[model samples]
Target chain A: MSPTSSLQPLERVRVAVDCMGGDHGPSVTLPACRAFLASHPNAEVLLVGTEESLRPAAGWSRCTLVPASEVIEMDDAVEVALRRKRDSSMRVAIAQLKADDEGHAAADVSVSAGNTGALMAVARYVLKTFAGIDRPAIAALLPNARGGFTKVLDLGANVDCTAEHLLQFAVMGSALVSALDGKDEPSVGLLNIGEEAIKGSETIKRAGELLRAAAAAGQLNFHGNVEGNDIFKGTTDLVVCDGFVGNVALKTSEGLAGMLTQMIKQEFSRTPMSKLAALVALPVLNRFKARVDHRRYSGGALLGLRGLVFKAHGSSDAFAFERALERAYDAARNRLLDRVHDRIRDTPAVLPTAPDEPAAAHAA
Target chain B: MSPTSSLQPLERVRVAVDCMGGDHGPSVTLPACRAFLASHPNAEVLLVGTEESLRPAAGWSRCTLVPASEVIEMDDAVEVALRRKRDSSMRVAIAQLKADDEGHAAADVSVSAGNTGALMAVARYVLKTFAGIDRPAIAALLPNARGGFTKVLDLGANVDCTAEHLLQFAVMGSALVSALDGKDEPSVGLLNIGEEAIKGSETIKRAGELLRAAAAAGQLNFHGNVEGNDIFKGTTDLVVCDGFVGNVALKTSEGLAGMLTQMIKQEFSRTPMSKLAALVALPVLNRFKARVDHRRYSGGALLGLRGLVFKAHGSSDAFAFERALERAYDAARNRLLDRVHDRIRDTPAVLPTAPDEPAAAHAA
Candidate 1:
């Protein structure tokens, strides 16, 4: 409970959670909710789903029940998002956010670990689209050698993407880095097969032209085309790709983490002396572990949505769920939804501007 | 050398070398050719390219010059393989392998470190296609957790591959496994995003279906669908994919190796004590370095061609070039090409009954 006392207090941030999502269900969600509430005593939480299913999950005093009679299966089609998962906790959560006649539309945020496809589908359908945004994008943060990773999107939300979609993703991602990483202008790199200005799939090449023009216009800090090999090199603050390759690259990196960790364990076990050395170096090892913990980062915000919606790992463990709660709290406190709104809406079609230009050119 | 003394003095295999191919050209290739000829004293070499270019290079002895007039530039289009570079090093090298009048064609191989697309085009044209093959495929070996690693194919030869093309790759890869790793019947894992029997892009899904039929008919050992995250988990001996994803995976792995090695060096430099530990482990470090050196396995054989076509790395240093030469010499001396031919030609449509009878039937 001292977290409230341990830090500066701010206005309460309401976070609606899909209590019925994830593999462990109420077993993990209930405890995390209690932990989060204990830490941030002023926060409000709406636990969505059937009362029968969420009753046990409502042990925390910080939680309020948002009852519904639907549950969407993981295997359900994306169309179900339009139909409202009849029994899905995710739908009920969104419904509760939508009904905030008390000025909730612009104040609250939603978080889900349910079917990612469904979350995007329903969020776009119910929350409506952000002005000037054509689709919602899933952007992930990776540990970068040069500090923070560049965001790569349409992670897996849309398979068939146009060059315009790539351009939009770059803009949204740049806005994020500026707000979150405190970079007034973050460099953007288009993912391609070559680092040359003249490379990649025909689509990527065309996207390059648009991005370069935008960068020249000062809309983005376009760093030119970067190869898949350059993603972890931290060559840029954002990476643009179609959903298919982006998803594959994301999964491949995740898989490599598991593979490399397993290899390290085996390598350490190869000799008793090395095991002793490893034991002595546990603190340094802990530093490395903390440096790469995905759970600490938790959910990836589904950007370009009118309402704030974050996606936790479908297979996230307890700690991951706790971090998810904090992320929702942070996003709400940050007024991320409104920020996304003004950034997209207020930007001129010309995007960037030359140095010494009037700040009011945004009105043009 | 002693191993050669024990042989029955069988006729040595002859191989044509593309002296002008690769980034280092004469600087790297000339020494590599001499070292290769020295290792296998009885082997005959036909060094293809202009005599003037080869003359000033270091260590040019033990090679029989087969003159080529034109040198194909690295960025040349595949069209050059048909016209302008007809007498280029890459084309002339393959021509030597196809001409029976050249004395070497009866039992010889060809090697290049040229433009991958051009090499494929020229090899296809000069060597022609094998009896049951429609196209030649590029194959590379990746390190796996288990010793001997998996042999991956269609690295980037065909962008849009058919089910039959993938199936044939499985067949050819199987024979290569037998020739290179001595695995009589290697299990083929169809690369996809998930490990379940069902999952992947439309192309992989269809290839999985065809593999199921082929495996059931005892043509190859099919190990079902494999996830990208589990690629190095040793689920199978060979992973088959179309050119696109495979190229991405290959390059991603290479780039990762660079990033990780750099990170480790930085980590070890954190303090004086860690640096001291690093110094003491120099010998062991060398062993570890050798274990993961990509150059040790730089050359990959282009399977299903009428004549041998070994592809070396263009960025290969002197050591890497030597390793490629070694691989080329081993392929020729060990009768690898002849073995591929016999296996593809004679391996029964009904492969010999194996231990895992249920696998093929259960995979698709």
Candidate 2:
């Protein structure tokens, strides 16, 4: 067979996924897998997890199982992820991806809807990173006013990150945009307290400088520092930050969305006349719903990994899981990891200026 | 004259509002102000801007016009805040608040739906902070799960803060929560990256330590550290955060709420059948409409100030402005500032830990 790295057409790519992950786990993941398989006849999934769990997901002919002896409970601590990847579903999923060289299936991507920290640790240790990437950021697409979604990285990876790590996120995020949005070089923004470069923590200020220099050198669409309020405003296509802030921003957005939707449910229950008005406005409502539901885009792509590794939401349903597998297949077809590695390798390394000397020396 | 601070059940609390501060400034603010006065029988409003601008919404009284020489454009930088305070409607509104205090008319609150940074700077500098408090925080009351709201403070007061500042926010948030919810010494949460003591930035850690000692001493109802996700979960009654992160959290929450609500509206309208379900559930929909309409909670009490300072939404309708004034009256009557002072004063000064003895000595 041609080398597995050949720009494999969607039909040639195989995606390995954790059959049991997330709240809806098998119920959601299996159906989604079948749905994805139904559309892409050649795209197959090596469903990794307990065989007993797989038996219930019945109707798939193209996909097979890679049984995992153990399962990691959603509530299991992060420590378990590193120590027990030998048996856990997430670990088995990665092991299947790493087993690509043997050509058993040439698994191009690994997908799991598991505990986030555990996934990050596994992806980091198992897949490793691109040459310049010290940390692989968890990139997710957010809905914007422009009818397009933006990618944000470090969504909840490392709580405390260095400016250098943010720089790496920008590089990887830039590549992901190329792979996903077809943008030659998507604009990169450093999520900050304010738009002004001078305003933010020391790390942000440092990252701003690196991004600015990179922008000047024609690397990213470097849109100076962006405030948290600007994320939904769609000021830029890509936002980068340390996981601490990114996690907070993401979760805060989710919380607010949950709160608003709940409140909307209550408001619709109010008076009869208002309900009538809502009926008339249902079309407009659905447009808004699809724009914000995020179910289709729930799986976050782990950038800078050796291969495509998509983390579906732990609370994901089958639709969410299927969407993730599709994303993984796309990433594999696009050779996202190789592209990131190449782009990063080709770019002139950002050299240290006097002020950035210490940061340059700092390990991300 | 009796203190205006006492809500002795006056004819209606008169509120002076700067109508030219927000993006939609006059159009939205004008109508909102009119709507507010109409709903609340005892509400009176002084619309400050140019006479020409106020005419459209001033068909009836409860509202009068206060002409200003120039309007403070929203795009003007911070420098414009101080320089144009003499000519701007926002400054004019603050001046009205002070003038009313002297005249014993004491407009219950001066509401502004304008430049937040300018509003906060002008209000605090002109109004000054309350006794024993160094700064005021724009406290946001978010809709929580228990059919109630939780308060988060220092939304954008200061970018750089200290442990003392957080301590003060906890004290003030407590007072405001008690005022709004009748909850005594409400549970207070320090907004950190994680619930664990080991989590957060150095400053947050320091603040957490201070809060721990204070809580142990029975000063505030400190519930250790609360992650950003916990904010929407409504695990605590009060959340204390520095201005930078707090501002981001509050604005992000608001933006997310608006985005999601818009999405839900669109999703319910995707097809003819869904539209019919919406039509059938018209009354249910109307009930929901009343629930998430942000106009109802369009104002926030500016905590830690000597006098009640209220912030109406930038797009506040007359109804929202009226509610803001109402919130101001409630805050003042509840002795928000005085209660904060009392609690803070009663708590003995917390000394730095032995680990920071050298730094403390150096500062002293």
Candidate 3:
């Protein structure tokens, strides 16, 4: 759990930004990038998009315009992102993380607010997966009732995950939390219907066994099983599940929050008395909203990849996108990629393929 | 769909109550039953519990005390409820729905606030599944943004579901909604990660195909694939999914709601000024709270069983338990059983084994 690099002025953390992704494209990304640069003195940004599209950030300090010919729409299929849009801003942004002939990478990390499927496909194809990892997973922080964020992974990345995959996710998630949150050891909970070992599908039961074995071997801080409610209760530092379930939980939370917010607004505007009350309660309500705002937790790091890649919400505003940028910068500064490798290297018994698998072949 | 029985002076809807079930047991059940009886003059209640516990409701009008020797605790295992506690109140309540030698059921419906696993196991064993239904599903109403309840099924009934099981859930969910909500044809949506047909697991894709086939054959009002958020958005009248996913989604929604409620309270009570604002906003806040209260939406109907069985939350108060009883009563009065049978009988093409499978064999 040592820092990979000292916070020296000479060591600049470069983040490649996909300027033409998300709903607002440059409008959100540019402003967020500007704010991000203003805060970090020793940080650089590789603006990856069409030359004309990135014209606004052309003369910005410590910013490099990495030209990309095409744009990947939020609705584009995986095939379109992987094959047809080879020069997509997302692909070029990810490509900046690839090492050069002299073994120096153009960017330390990449961030995109693009379609999840497209980003995953493009990133996996360009930079490739890390050694011992069969598939890369989407990892994000969910705000919990404990007033802290619980890291959840495999969120819509690999829908049909195996028991071994769950164990891998646990290892990857632990590293991400340790590197970013600075928690040396984080407890991981296997998400299931019931806390009992016998509950859930065959895959889940098998996953529990693997996680327990990993825990016994001192590889993961496995915390038995947890229900969906446990995610918000902050019962564990990390909650691991298959992509489908994770995706559903994330979207369900969003949906419920949206409904409640609307309901509150509707209730306050129902009568003149209520309107007066709302006016009085305005400051308190705004403070409450800020505390639970999803924008503060906008980044979803793509774990198990050779290079660091992050995803922001497709509908992110400047504030939200800036949070994503800050998250990516923190992950890069904390040496997330090396931390993942260290965890995988140390836990070879849990991940048997690490030693034998060649880097290039594993990436492919 | 035609009514199985017209409202008449002789036609009294009887509901069997598992008085010994739930956290408060008789404390909650008795008051709920009393309120239910007062509301529906023609409705009779079969209070199934030990005679000692039922002594308080002894001479109540239209209330019959059906004595049971044992009680199933909230945390009792399914095996304990099925094998050991044969005469448990939960079992006895479900038994009241079984047809007697004279071909008449003792009760029209049953309600319990016991553990879900034990209740489902006992209900399935005693009442048996309906013909063509391989596994029973738990259907419940969730408050949606459109000011209506979205009927979601398989809320932790059968963990491992096949494509056929999902189709069965859709049919049963459709029946439940049509009967309870009085919708002639309720549109059913298959819960998935995305709205696209090819976005989920293999089983989901197959379920989507089967649903489309059923729709083409004019059996179900299939609304195609829906994301988890769609459930709250009121995209469809019914959202069908496997028990595992449904359970996770249900618990996740509960978790988010609880967190938001707590946050709102904390925010309003932070300071003297905030508390004063809260005093002013008390009426509006209470109104908003009532609208989104989960208690109003209590009761998960165990569908696909031969008899009607509704499950209240184990932690239900008198008001919440009453909601469950009312739901059961409405379901019974609306002829939910007959509706399910009619739907199953009509969609034989979608259910291949319905014509050939015997009731007893399917039950086993």
Candidate 4:
């Protein structure tokens, strides 16, 4: 058994959930919270939302309601959510994860199925970035061929990142997989157009050098540059790229997967002969579906923040939201935030040189 | 029937093949040439390679060998091929597509499965860009849910693209799809992080405005901003983006598809029950494979060049290279190059404003 498994039974993990968020709002989140509480006996939830809508979860012994009058809509602008809705459910939930009385965190972690832009804005404001970290990145788990998952960072957080920002992402991502997956030294692959060292933009090429220096210092297991295919091939445990490239890659894979699934079903049901074949293929197809299910990969942790914050899919159902909560619980129980802090603090600086500066200045 | 079909019966199309390129080199290219010649009775091939490799296809009535001394290795740098290997087979094949006597082109199109960088360098140096076009984009067909293909451009040609470069790609892609797919005004989607105008980088946002203006002027059908998923959903006939984003998206889809296929097979063969199920579901599986076969989508045309150039996958087998050849044949026979030139020339100028200039300067 792991250290986290031992801590899970002895201590209670306080989870602050934004109940008014997501597509179904309270209908989905309340039932998921009920289910989550049942499974995790030592877990408690502070459900933040409108009191009237969150009344369904009021009866749960382990659940408490933190009423907030305002709600951030799905399509609300970041500025509107940040300045206009100060006491919004999403903001209140994130605030619960902030440091409180006796220098202890009010909630171990916070999970929200809300507008990503608004959530990021509020989370950054409530729990500012960790020391030495410039910006927080959105890290998500993607299914790989190894039957395991690869952690990809900066999914859509920082669109235009410098080489130093990429190096920071690598450090944060390394800390993440190490804490959650129990890998002592996780391999980090810098996402590029090709595996060759000479490939990619000036920012990426410089980032590769920093990653190499970090690997040399035993800070990370740098796998050099990897192409997009390497992400699914599980060439490394962690992949790092700018938000623009990473977001495009993630969405493209989702789109292609959906198309292929639709095409497979259409082919199987096209004619009477094929329909008979589909009946026999049902079991195998179900197994395949379970292996690549998007619901299994619902949560994206907003890394580099001083506190643990996870963003569940905005359109998540009860089951999907539950998975996101479980992911957060695991991270909190394992003390992911502390691990990141320690890792970033201990590592020797690998800051990139400015574009106009001499290349010698970048040497650590 | 299309105008190309009418012209096919009266005229014979000459194609130049770089037989020394790709993984299999002469072995794959030779047999694919034989099959191509057999299918297109009104077509001839100029096989460019070493004299030793040319000996195998000497007996074909319509096939003529154009021997070249040097061969560009797959890993060779662009400068090496450009400055050193002047007599390379890939260079010679591209040269055949250039205008020869009486201002008439020597070959309708040229096909090569060599190093992409080297091929692009040689093609640009020999053929040059079309009038008013800055750079050539790599455009390929991707299978979509509509059972047809969507043409995507600038796969990896120009990494850092300006807004004006994106507009050029849009114009070129529109013309290619229009002539080959018979769409009078094919819809072009600007690949972005989100559909909202507020999302994406400054370059992409400006490109969107230019595209909208082009659409209003009746030069192309601009479908505003689309997420990566829209590429496979067939939301538009053509998707345009900078080389970095487009390359990452394309490769990620390929990687995910490959992983899914592997997982499906592994699941089917895992248990005795599943083995029997696999046997019964062979027909449906075959249909699924046929629908999403990567080999069927091998060729990516090097658009905006003065002469027509099509690139085959470096690792293509006989059948895959044949698909590339056939695609080039289709593009050549349909007068794709001429169509692109005409479309770009007739379209009203919607150039992007200079970075330092006011937004009002772009209202053309």
Task: Tell me, by DockQ, which candidate is best.
Answer: 3
Predicted candidate 1 versus true structure: per-residue lDDT over A1-364, tens digit per residue: 1111122223777778887777766667767777888898779888776688777754567678787777666666778756745557887676555534334342277777787878888877776665566788888766577756556676777555678778878877776665456465778888776676654556677788888877776567888877777777778888877766676666656665655555656555567766665665555445556666778765577888756777888777778888887866775565555545555544455333223211110111
Q: Write the per-residue lDDT of candidate 2 for residues B1-364, one digit (tens) a residue.
A: 1121232333456677788877677876777677767667777778889878888965677778888877766666667887755778888787665533223434556777776778777777766665556777889877776666778887777666788888888877887887666666689998876677877777778888888888887777788888786787788999888887777777667666665555555556767866676666666666656665677776587776545567877766666665676676566445554555556555555632223111100011
Candidate 4, B-chain TM: 0.93
Which digits, one per residue and each the tens of the lDDT, describe model 4 over residues B1-364? 1122232211677889999999889999999999999999888999999999999998898888999999999989999999999999999999887675445666778999999999988999998876667888899899998989989998988888888899999988987886678776788999888998778888888899888888887777888898888999999999999897888888888889889999999999999999999998898899889888899998699998887899999999999999999888888777777667666666646643223211010111
Candidate 4 to truth, TM: 0.93
User: What shift in Å separates residue A234 of candidate 2 from its native position after superposition?
Assistant: 4.0
Expressed as tens digits, the lDDT of each residue in B1-364 for candidate 1 is 0111122213666778898998988778777777777777777777888879777543545567878999887888789767776789888888777644323353267778888878988888877766666778888877666645677887767655777778778877876776566566788987765565554556667788878987776667888887555556666778787665566667666665666666666665678876665564444444556667889877588988877788998888778877776666666665555555555554345233223211110011
Please, what's the RMSD in Å of model 4?
6.3
True-contact fraction in model 2 equals 0.44
Estimated TM-score for each candidate: 0.79, 0.80, 0.96, 0.93
Worst 10 residues of 2 chain A by lDDT: A355-364
lDDT of candidates 1 onward, in order: 0.68, 0.71, 0.87, 0.85
**Candidate 2 per-residue lDDT over residues A1-364, each given as its tens digit:** 1121243344477788887778777778878888898998768778887888898655667777888877777777777878854688888887666534333434778888888778888777876765566677799988765667778888877656887888888878877877776566677778876777767777778888888877777666788888776677777889898776677777777776776666665565456765666666656665666566778778698887665788888888777677778777777767676556655654465732222111110011
Which candidate model has the greater lDDT, 2 or 3? 3
Q: Regarding DockQ, does 2 or 3 come out ahead?
A: 3
Interface RMSD of each: 2.9, 3.8, 0.7, 0.8
Better structure of 3 and 4 per lDDT = 3
lDDT of 3 by residue, A1-364 (tens): 3232232222678999999999999999999999999999879999999999899997999999999999999888899999898889999999888876555678888999999889988888987887778999999899998999999988888888899899899998988887778777789999999999998999999999989888888778899999999999999999999999998888888888988999999999999999999999999999999988999996599998878899999999999999999888888877777777767877777686546332221122
